[model samples]
Target: MAYPIIFLLFLSLPFSSAKLNLDYYKATCPDFENIVKENVFIKQTAVSATAPGLLRLFFNDCITDGCDASILIASSAYNRHPERDANPNLSLSGDAFDIISKIKNNLELVCPGVVSCSDIVAQATRDLVKMVGGPYYKVRLGRKDSKVSDAKRVDVNLPTTKMTMDQIIEKFTAKKFTIREMVALNGAHTIGFTHCKEFSDRIYPKVDVTMHPKLAAGLRRVCQNYTVDTSMVAFNDMSSPNTFDNAYYKNILKGLGLMTSDYLLSVDPRTRPIVEEYAKDQQAFFVDFAKAMEKVSVLGVKTGNKGEVRNRCDQFNNNIPE
Candidate 1:
């Protein structure tokens, strides 16, 4: 299948949210939201990691190329490498991927090809947030899956734990996100775990001065041998790792943020106030996060013939006659 690389134009343009609708799948699949809700509940309850994994997967997909499901595409004979194979995306929660697959499979049984994987990502994300004690918001649907899924796209564009706060901000800004919005989106740290390797530098060789002594000592004890067992992990918010709330900002304010990108939210003057405000009020954080997630979900979105509704979330529908 012939494909075009996603252009820098996606970054350059102001995102248009006009095409998506709050009830996009209503007529086509009236049971859409319920389907996603059922699967997310089942997956999340059975696998404690499901909510965070799914949330991270949704974040990775949207940040890279709108909220299209290109991130879910597997490397195949037609395309030897896809976004999930990229180093930055390699840590995307398997439970997240599994839940999306579960939802897609269920949707097919009820509604056939009517629902797109991209929309599933958006809807599932919204449902999961509310399920995890975050504010609920309507996610506009009708986002079509992208035709392309190159590993190169993921390599060059995704944010990393190692990136400076300014660099991360630049990336989000290109997606039309304000610094306040970036801080709120990252409040997602309220639920997930990150591997020790992502923050080992702050604890090893020499302690990073920015970290609180207590936090540093704790991290060093847990991750001292991360080089040998790379699977060692730490929660982003030790206070309530399973809940989506303002505790992540509270942790950052106390110098307990798990990664450089996280720790700098309090140190960066432009973002500190937002972090402080959120830490003071969980409802405020929830409100801002809902708005931020809604905004980011539609950036550079593809609709109509710009993309297709894939039959399989894990591969393109190109082999079938278009």
Candidate 2:
């Protein structure tokens, strides 16, 4: 009896560890990643914002309840409020959700009920970064989609654009991200656009002295009557709005950062060094960003039998009672 119990424990060790790995789907779905990449390319070319949008989707998904695709869940009859309706997540591009759904549909055609939406979202994020000329890192798969999502949890876990560097650092650090990793992850801003309303406070009434005078003037022109036309937008990284590189950090160094949180990365004594380092070395930034992304992608991940692979990206498994 003792020997049998010890053998059972040994057999459970792999699942007990709960670590994700590159070959998670090797036996079950060999063509899984290629399919995700093809779908990403299709969505990305159709919409220029798709790349950054998907990347943002990955971050938001992970920060809340790990990268379990809870953010993709829509409100159902049982749960009237979902994470998607959260204030912080309100600005997420709808195209990202559509792209993930399309990819999940494609995967089901070939490997039905095998690839989880969580894994598909993770793979799409890596493909999107590579599509945008960023580092292509190996993603550990095997994440299961969450069956539950709450709006209140989103507000507690995510940092807003208006947060100070200390607040942002605290949030990321709580997730086991280092100060350096926090700074590197913020580099995702290199490729996205922000509405004028998100940053008008930095310029109106009194321009933030941290902003470069000329950059402030340019933003003022672009965001004229920002109070009335909140829809006006600007590139997060003015120099390389479409590229994923150290240009975002360079912008911060030059006082051209579009958000208060972004500008504070350079002004804060704790994060300034990492900002300056990444500003100077593109490769270094890429390496650290990839590591940080990989680490964050698996935070609080649910594996094994803890969650289920949803056939539809936007809804929970129908068989499971709400």
Candidate 3:
């Protein structure tokens, strides 16, 4: 069938060579990852939710012009708009930026000028995942901080909760991610929360048939007064709000997926099988997720002489040069 053909094509897609390697900082900064992990653990203790926030930050940064830390750039006096200013990125946690800044400061103390802000983000994402009981995967470093960031690009490239299966697939395919990879990456939803405004459509007008009736009722209760307070929130995976396990996929199987795209992974014929596989096998999900994360993290990356190591994670290197 079409599913098998698609799976074959996914297997056949050649991995892009981003020139990133595991040994990138071995000679220059052997303690790079340790510094990042230590800071992430310290921040995680104060805000238990920092893990998902950092994970989301990594995904946002990578999806837009690769994982060059472009998302970390703040709009300045010269340029009034940056990637984080975009509507799609408004939900991104400011804490993510703060945590990365903390890690960057500590790294500069030891490896002054050797580490890049982009690499800090990538490494911190891995450390955050491990801290939250997720699989520990090696991440290739050596990414440079991007100098350019545009708010417009985000609306064009980022996937939203309301996106249909086809739209989501097309977005991922543009980044060279396969359908299976897209599904696995969606599993990251296991640990995050969604704004009520983002999913109120499924609850109002009419209950989406895909959502479990009881789950839908609970959502309605949580969001009944959301209009008065747009900041109302709900966990993405009700089964396990903090764990990075296969519970997200299993929740979808039970019609408990919180987002429209989440529900579609099961209802759509092309993605359902992959979702079922992940629900049954957490290891399979983790393996595929790690591979996908590695691949996606390097999309459109700038290496060599392309970008610079930012002194401050929130500003361009040229804007605040050392």
Candidate 4:
């Protein structure tokens, strides 16, 4: 799992170099990233869940159809089944969507229709990660918002908490991610919260032996009435719920990871060593995470005639009401 960061950088160059670059918006928006940063600071500071929410939003957007912000699209009367309407994405943070809209409206005030919502999702997510104690990574711009946002395309693309280690491996492998990259990407769970329904299976019907008794018991309390209180949720990282760090791996080591998938990563020999390395070395986790984000960010990106810069993120350029 000790893949060289230098080699990863080389592998990433192809995706980032052709149509995307660090300065893709330098001439067009001039202050694109700065605007994204400003909006993230304002909106994220007001909501404790904003940082992790936006990060998860990025994951949802990218993992399905690259980083084209398709997940941000609202289901219209004619298109009443956009990606956000998917069951897996039904729990996506509204604050995260609000932050992107905030950035979009603010940018339009100065840059007009120059910036793409897809790029905003990527940049704002990177800024938010740094805001909550994660590594600062560069995101290349120039991605155009996708014209597609099918909910049907989403369900199979998403990784759920109930997936076993083998299932998780298959999912990531289908996306071109290596086992080490898969483990590194899972580290993003460090800051996010999961709804009780997502993991109740792990704690109910007898707590799994791999889970610590105390952790299982506590989860029972939080999720006991989750069926009635759909909003009930728990943080993924027990050690530092809000901080983005290796505490997730540490929590897994102590049998405190909140999901079946998370617990499996600690015990699966193929992934456990990578998890152990991340737990012992925070920098390693950050470096690989940033790279994984980069790879995911650029996956299946749309360009040129394939995409467009949407004036309103919730609807496509042509779908905007006249």
TM-score of each: 0.92, 0.91, 0.91, 0.93
Summarize candidate 1's per-residue lDDT along 23-77 as a digit string, tens digits.
8887989999899999888887888778888888888888787778989988777
Q: Write the per-residue lDDT of candidate 3 for residues 1-322, one digit (tens) a residue.
A: 3578867755653333346778888988888877887889889888877889989988988898778888988888855788889998888887898999898888888889989998888888988888887888878777788878888889788988888889999999998789999999998988978888898999997998888999899999999999999778899888688888999999988999888888889889999999999999999999999888877777777877778888888888677322
Residue lDDT tens for model 4, 78-119: 678898999989999999999999999999998998899998
Q: After superposition, how far is residue 281 of candidate 3 from its true place, in Å?
A: 1.0
lDDT values, one for every candidate = 0.85, 0.85, 0.85, 0.87
Winner by TM-score:
4
Which portions of model 1 show Cα errors greater than 4 Å? 1-16, 319-322
Candidate 3: the clashing residue pairs are none
Per-residue error (Å), model 2, residue 143:
0.6
TM-score of 4: 0.93
- In angstroms, the error of model 1 at 185 is 0.9
Which consecutive 10 residues in model 3 have the weakest lDDT in total? 9-18
